[model samples]
Target: MEFRILTESSDWQGIIGEIWRFKGAPNDRNNPILPSYWQFLQIRLPELPETPIPKLATLSWFLREEQKRDWVDHRLVSIDPTLHVFSPTTEQVVFFWHGRNPSQGVIHPDFGEPGGSPWYDERPRLPRLRVEPSVVSNPSPGHLMPRPAFSPALTSAPGQVRKPKALSIILPYHNDPSHLFVPLQPFPDTRHTQTKTFQFPSRYYPLRFSQSNPNHEPILTNDTNEAWPASELEGLWLGSYGPHGTEVLYLHSPEECRINAWKVTGDVNVPRGVITWRFHSRYQTGPECIPPAAGLDSLPESCRIFKGSAHVCGTGFIPALESWIDCIVVVFDRDDIKVYWESLRHTSRYRRYKGRDISLETVPNESDSGIRVPPVWD
Candidate 1:
């Protein structure tokens, strides 16, 4: 009844990648250093009872899935579909975006009228599913979809638990985290040999993605920041901040009032899983929306600014000198977004991340050096 863990990176280069479970780091943790993204990333399965969810036996099944030949043999690292939905518990890492704040009662665009009313609690609640061993015809690889009728691995109990706890999804850009709240359409492809043998229905829904919202046109207003919705900046974005080079970020709006930026990959100072910055409307009506002409000339003439705060920390996040600095988001249409940290006194640009094709292509032939084989756990 536990959801297993895998390396944040899907690569096979040494110990940077390995499959693990709920237990903490192995003793002698120095051997295989866990990826920096680990702290910010964890997946949980639903407590729903009716779903024909099978116990995903960890190691032996992974070995059986391996068609042994060479250590260099390349294989597509497919994510376990069951790990998509994130059930946030009190013991788990509480994300700022997951706060129980009042939302504007928005719904996914695809859900239409029948997609049901917004949850009374005003948080995202993916539909409880009734899954069957089915194949997705021309499914978008790695896309999470749901059409009220079913989900991939978990099923809903009829008239019992009406609203399952909504989950935060983890999408990796080569170990850099990303999340999207599009729509969940069930496309279970239980076709793998071992999966078929064990009757494990595939939950990895392959989705067609768009790096840019070609159809979206922002509407500017005075009182309401209607231009800034959860879906407005909802995708993988690449941005640069001072010495931290270019890092990946995932943007989600927990409520209409704020857009939370979760770091997927970042510098030694800030690291992943932290809220790098978020946008709020308090300063939008003030003089702050008018961009300071100093270094922000690159932004288009048509830009709207929403004020926010940036997270600052020391190297390795030491001393807890964390400061919430003032910042602003310049929304020059949907495709082009920029940020200026007043305290850091710097400006940066952002764009949608068009994903790259990667393979977890290699594992060390000898186990003596890199990562010592972890002892079997209960």
Candidate 2:
């Protein structure tokens, strides 16, 4: 979706307040632009199999649910605006910019997960490169960066069938060229929408909103191999580097949500991290948890909260349990919760929740010992 900021401003709320004065640029008449945030964001049924889960709320009531979810729309990680070239393959989203500043560039993997066991593979496998820029321009919105294009070492027979390769493209913050990781033609698993559980190879690193045992915390023993936890973490995504290195982002799902939380087991790297630990959902309705001082602490003291509009009336509503829907985006280190966006329903008088609402208490009570599973396949 293309969003041409009519009047760009970092203050999102302020722009929202002055929406009455909003107008799309005249040059972009070919695109459908709405007068509200609805125009800035687009919603289409994800290209995935329909879930069989029963719906409790009516479609007419779903608008109010969306509004309640929008309250925290700002909390979602922002995609860099300078990114003009977006490469969405079966394996990952590769972004390229011609003149983007690399120094200020930081690739935020939609799926960032650091420090964990071999969720899929243990030993480090070399990255594969695909997608030859010289041959193609404007690849389909979600197309695969075929391996043979980039990697000469790839060996695939003429008639014998081969599995579709998954690619992970990694590059510096700002660079004209990018690299891809196309594993052996047929990786252990190549199903794009398929999700699985895996463990971290290390102990539960401290991440906020996660529980930790004081006694089991890593100690600075005299052993030379025992390296203490990292104090400064760049960020967490669905994929992680090997025991010593990092890779480009490699995750693709038109319909998928990844969640990760830090945890410790009797053995290191058995299960993946959980998004939220059990805590009281009810708060005092004031400044709740004190923000942990910026340092080595991995946990986020403040879990993100999203609120949207009225599903029924298409009017605004207060933050209520029924009004707020819960949607979680789990990766390797950080887990983000999203409530749906609100809109007016065709019918209905009362408001309703659009999606699900997640809080400490509302989070599912799944076993923390088993391998952490991706929410999409679940």
Candidate 3:
């Protein structure tokens, strides 16, 4: 079957907000705007399949200039249900966290147990380079470098007899050419017994300073540095680094981490209010624990460590929403996740109305609690 690509304008802010709320953002007194420890990508498949297991080939995100493309191989990890109990929509959404399977295609009987470990691998295994040198216009600014033309040969893995269909998507960017999400630097070399803490000004948020709004002021005014307790950094954190920023931080453990940073359009300093921390450890397993590296490679066999200088935005911060879009495109076998997709796609309003609401609602005197109410006219 030919590969099919479905594109949509992702409500990333709203989605992040919903996930934050699901993780107890309202009751979080410390940092209400802070996101939880776990982060997820909700995929709405084009068509539902009959089988329970959805066949996803790959998932990719068209990011800012520097790290032009971020791709994940399904063979490395599979998408599973989100840790949180709440979802914004009635669409039977399936949440998938970030991590890799150490066993490499091996299925665990428990499945839910920490079946596979997580590791970062920057090896150039794919047929095409994530950052194509041929299409790069300006070598100075990484993000502005154009992506190389796509070909079916580039998409297929080496030695695979059957080739999957190829689909190329062109994502639009409205912000300045030089400003892009700063790519995470390579993890510093360290011995197994050593514990190193590296700190740098994060370029997660677009630099948008307003002389009027004090709330818009950056936490890192100068080159000031702050030491964060590893224990305190357990949950998800949503904050900006630049003058204007939108970024997600997922700290599964002291060793494992995942981040989603973007230079979005508009004066929105940080999505869903200011930078804050949301604690949701109950919903997450610690970062994938990888065994120690024995040989030359410091990291495990399939893992790669990322640690480097933080990124910063270039000039030209546009306030138009139509200028850019946050999108995630997945190439999966048509059959994978079909049943779940169909259930969500075809869910009836009446059935949703009949169902009880399990989301937490804040009351005047009472603490935030999950309130179940029948669907009705406001």
Against the true structure, candidate 3 reaches a TM-score of: 0.19
RMSD (CA, Å), each prediction: 18.4, 24.3, 25.0
Quote each prediction's TM-score.
0.39, 0.16, 0.19
Model 1 misplaced stretches (Cα beyond 4 Å): 1-230, 286-294, 298-301, 356-378
Give me the displacement of residue 318 in model 1, in angstroms.
Answer: 3.2
Q: Count the backbone clashes (under 3 Å) in each candidate.
A: 11, 48, 26
Question: lDDT of all the models against the reference?
Answer: 0.41, 0.20, 0.20
Any runs in candidate 2 off by more than 4 Å, and if so which?
Answer: 1-92, 96-218, 221-360, 363-378
Specify the highest-TM-score model's number. 1
The digit string of per-residue lDDT tens for model 1 on 52-146 reads: 86643222112112245454322422332233342321111101111133211111111111212121224333434332222212212122222
Worst 10 contiguous positions by lDDT, candidate 3? 331-340
lDDT of 2 at 290: 18
